[model samples]
Target: MSEPVKKKAVQHLLVWMPNWLGDVVFALPTLQALRKQYPEARLTVVARPPVSEILPCHPDIDCVIPIPTEIGKRALAQMRFAFSLRKYHFDLAVILPNSLRSAWLTLLSGAPRRIGYETDGRNFLLTDPLPVVKESRSIHGSDYFAGIVKPLGIETVDKTYPQLLTPDAIGKQRELLKRMGADPSRNLVIAVAPGASKPEKRWQTERFGILCQKLVKDKDAKILLFGSGGERELLDEVRRFCPGKSAFLLAGLNLQVVAGLLGNCRLLVANDSGLMNFAAMIDTPVVGIFGPGHPKTTDPPIAPERKELVTLNFECSPCRHRFFKECEPSPNKKPFCLEDITVTQVARAVDALLDRLA
Candidate 1:
């Protein structure tokens, strides 16, 4: 035998997933890689309530701890919640977010080896601070996440995309689709999500409706619509613009259930939202619409043959890291960034996807 193998010190790992649903979904590959590297470590994920639902069912995660409050708000609730993490006695903390609050929580959790990117003044909080490389159009999210562990002798990082599949959720998704008049026999299922984290990121709802209608009419594809409770208005706009029996709306379902449903689709056209990441995770082809965000950093890391996605081309693309609460639109003006994107452009993208699928 060569030399005696040194035993790893850590037994419990706490992964601080991103607070936003989309970002949280994007972080799954990192979680999976950690699980593979530390097979015996009790891997726990700490996330907000909505995002928490997706982690529990992941095969890599041993447990999920819901962050008690909106970590986005730097309030007393967040402080108390940070203290609550101390009970887990996490040996390793993986901070995925670039937020100072996330760093503070990792510090308060008392985890000796805190791993994260060196940014947002959070570098001091981390024991293993990886350099945050500045690049445009090449820094994929999965690769960016894996860079942190490069110094720790963990190589051969898995390049697989986000993974999630619960049998019950999958079964329920099938039943729900059937009830919505989607035929399982025909695999020509197409879905569109007319909502994003913000109005700025969202492609025009009318544009989405027109695309759905065209897909139903020309390709006879069964179109389905998805979103959260907040997307009801956009969904209504999709329905109104369609003006016929072309698509079905399935919003506000449990997040995993929605993911499972999206998994069954042949194609998914969505904004740069959590659903886009979820669709990528389930290996569904996607036509992701990007605006007010960096597609280079956040686009689904699937093969080009899977789907042909569309994003707007404006000089003022990617307005903010996170969305603003209520940015007022100008009088006699729509969100021109997304409005500039035409339904014809989206339809062409979808057509290219269909050709690839065929």
Candidate 2:
């Protein structure tokens, strides 16, 4: 009789999560699968600062270690973080982000098995480099992450929407809404996220303001402006265009608080941003405005009946370029792909979604 094959023991696992909020939301399915695969193993997540804010307290993850966003400026901190990880002696490492830095960190921690996609020229650093499929290149973000982890003996079926807030979090958010003068009982609450990490991805603030005004006038919807501290000016611009009683600006709030507040919203209107994905995760209906970002690859993974994407399909619609310098500007010096998406189009989409809800 042939000898029984020995299963390798894996006691500790480390996952280097994606830096962006949307990407992290997309990767939650894989994280959950990893937990189910190794229920007894200690799983640790190394992530960027914003990740801590978005991820709910879950038993799947044993602990979370946060790192600075600017890795280039914090070489000492990176080294210290890597050294600290070495103490855990993780048996396996999963690199979710395609950046070379993420792969380097996994190598630094000395994990025996490093699994990741063979992208960003970091194949040499990965022990099990998965090939990028053409089909996955244009699919939802959650599907892309699921494909990478399929080789780990985990079934990738059932790509359900990820949840970010617990019951307590929802209650806290209701209290926050009361404090902010938003009466969910009286009017339908609509959350608006006007800022994105890249300028190319953001729709005009003026258009957002116009949309809010129309919603307030026609639908009697209460607008909640959500963004970071840096986006305060953009939020202010929208506020300037809106009636004071119709809109409330909630900038610079922590991620958990924002998620809680978003949970109470009936709808979310946002650019192709992290908060856009957050809304989808929490089961809120979303109307996403796409510019340079490709909807196929990054659209919120929500049910079709509950979400809508507004975009102008020009030849150069999804340039995918990070900066304006790399893009070919229109006569008005703005990317027509987004600039051409008129206020009327967005308002119509929002109206359609609200109609469905009603």
Among the numbered candidates, top TM-score falls to 2
For model 2, residues 1-358, the per-residue Cα lDDT tens digits are 0121112567888889998888888888888888878788888999887777655475578888777566655768777678778989998888999888889888989897888888889989988888866666457788888877777866564666445577898888888777777877767899999999877677877788888888888877889999988989999899877776778889988888887888889889999898898788878899999888778778787889999899876665456564567766665455778878889999998889988988
* lDDT (Cα, 0-100) at 233 in candidate 2: 91
lDDT by residue for model 1 (1-358), tens? 1121122766898888887876766577667777777788899888887788777777788888887645557677777787887888888888888888888878987887888888887778878776776752356677676666555455657767544566676677888777777865564678888888766677766678778778877877787788888887778778765545657778787787777787678888988887887787778889987766657778776777886767665555555433333344533244555566788888888888878887
Off by over 4 Å in 1: 1-7, 70-74, 136-138, 161-163, 166-168, 186-188, 292-295, 311-337
Which pairs clash in model 1? 292-318
**lDDT, candidate 1, residue 315?**
55
Clashing pairs in 2: none
Residue 29, candidate 2: Cα error in Å is 1.0
How high a TM-score does candidate 2 get?
A: 0.91
Any idea what lDDT model 1 has? Answer: 0.74
